[model samples]
Target: MTEKIAVLGAGSWGSILANLLDENGNDVRLWSNSEAQAAELNDHHTNQHYVPDFHYSESLTAYTDLAAALDGVAAVLFVVPTKAIRSVAQQVAAVLQQTHQKPIIIHASKGLELETHKRLSQVLAEEIPADLRQAIVVLSGPSHAEEVAKRDITLITAASEDTKAATFVQQLFMNDYFRIYTNNDVIGVELGAALKNIIALGAGALHGLGYGDDAKAALMTRGLAEISRLGVALGAQPLTFIGLSGVGDLIVTATSVHSRNWRAGNELGSGQDLKTVIETMGMVIEGIPSTKAAYELAQQQSIEMPITEAIYDVLYNNADIKQVIPQLMRREGKPELQ
Candidate 1:
């Protein structure tokens, strides 16, 4: 069956996923807010600014009109940044209401709403009414856009309360080089996906400061503890922290050179100001905002996330990274499982 799918966002991850869907024999409409981007994709089948030296599937089309891109689609994938999710969802809600089309809503964005500290799934569900959408799903894991574009063996999780909806997504994207696993623990999956970026920022900062491997390993291990701790406090499954969305995502994001969060952290650790690094990155480094959201959430939940707090101090309070390191080290340690 050739399903018509609308992938909303024309950035690197969005373009890659849209092309993959088109390659999987779907009628894909990639929505970009920029007219130039739409024209670039439509005319030359390339999104060079975001994914350089890559060609998109010829059949994949790009659209500037929201209604046209969403017309008669079976599924809508929100691939925009975390901050843009709600606004885009609002636009989609209006369009769906006008067309009377109900499609499964899936999002690849991994971050919390800064103001509300809600998961991206929760943000989508809030703006798009239940009547206008079949189900809300989160597709996340360790996969990166550059690797997926190369057709590297990539595995991810499709999570939703609706098993059939998740299965629908699993079947939609799985191929020779791509694999999808379905998980019911949406809270854990989303938390792990969002919080790992914070840890990645810390890892990058460690590398920037010329810290050795032992320090990097300790930060990641203790960072996972903090992620699992806060996640479980918010009613997530404890075991889910050990799954692909949890430890798997943490490892890749914290260690990979392709990670924007890590790169941003590296710049910060190397003594570049946050504003300058963000202005120069040319892409959204999700960890900066995620650190703020997670830090505030931790305070509200009364959860102790020391590594998150340390990173937060450096990013927000203008604390010195060298000084922050020793402070984190001086904290009285407890049992590993605690």
Candidate 2:
């Protein structure tokens, strides 16, 4: 059976997933808020703003009309930034009200919104109509959209309270180059995806400060501990943090050059100001705000997250990044895994 999928947000991640769906024999309609971007994809079969070298699939259609994209769609795939989830979900809900059937939503955004401090899935659940929340699923992993679009081997996970929804999404995206796994721990999956970027920024900062393998290893370990503490505080299963969504994502984001957060940290460590670095990258760097949010979350939950706090101070308070190194080392520490 051919499924009709509406992919919202015409960014690299959205385009890659839309291509994956097209390869899986689904009818994909890609919707971009920017009409110009939609037209470019519709006419040129390329998202030149993100991935230009790859060819777009003929089975995919691009549209600026939200209603047209949602019409008769079996599933909705959201690939926008975490900040845009609420407004987009509200639009989707309004459109679905005029439609005959509600589509199952599968999204791949990472990062919690700063204002409400809500996770993407939580925002969707709060904003989308009650009936649609049950069918929501989140897909996340160490996937760099550019690599995935190039047919690189990328493994990801689909998580939802509804196992059926997870399985359906897994089947929708699995391909020769893209592998999908199903899990029911939405909390763990989303947190793991969002929190790693913050830690990656810390890792990059350490690297920029001329730290070696020993320091990097310590930061990664402590970063994972901070991630686990926040996850535990937020009702995530303990073991999930050790799995793909947690350790897997942390390793990739903290180490990969493709990570925007890592790159930002590298620039910061190399002594570039935040404003200058952001202007140079010219793309969304998700780690900066996420670091602040995670720091707030730790404080609220009474969870001890030293790495997140340290990064938050360095990022916001203009705390000396180089000075924080010895400060962390001097802290009276207890057992490794307390």
Best by lDDT: 1
lDDT of each: 0.94, 0.86
Question: Least lDDT summed over 10 consecutive residues: which range in candidate 1?
Answer: 329-338
* Inter-residue clash pairs, candidate 1: none
Candidate 2 contains a number of clashing pairs equal to 0
> After aligning candidate 2 to the native by TM-score, how far in Å is the CA of 291 from where it should be?
1.0
lDDT of 1 at 239: 87
Model 1 TM-score, 2 decimals? 0.99
lDDT string for model 1 (257-291, tens) is 89999898998889899999999999999988899
For candidate 1, give the lDDT of residue 118.
97
Clashes of each: 0, 0
Per-residue lDDT over 1-338 for candidate 2, one digit per residue giving the tens place of the 0 to 100 score: 47998999888888888888888899899999888888878787888878867789876889889999888888998998888889999999888876756678888998989977788988887777766444889999878888887788988889999989899898888878889888888998999999999989988887887888898888888888888888988999988888888888899899888888999999999999988988998678888888888888888889998788888888899898888878888999699887
Worst 10 residues of 2 by lDDT: 125-134
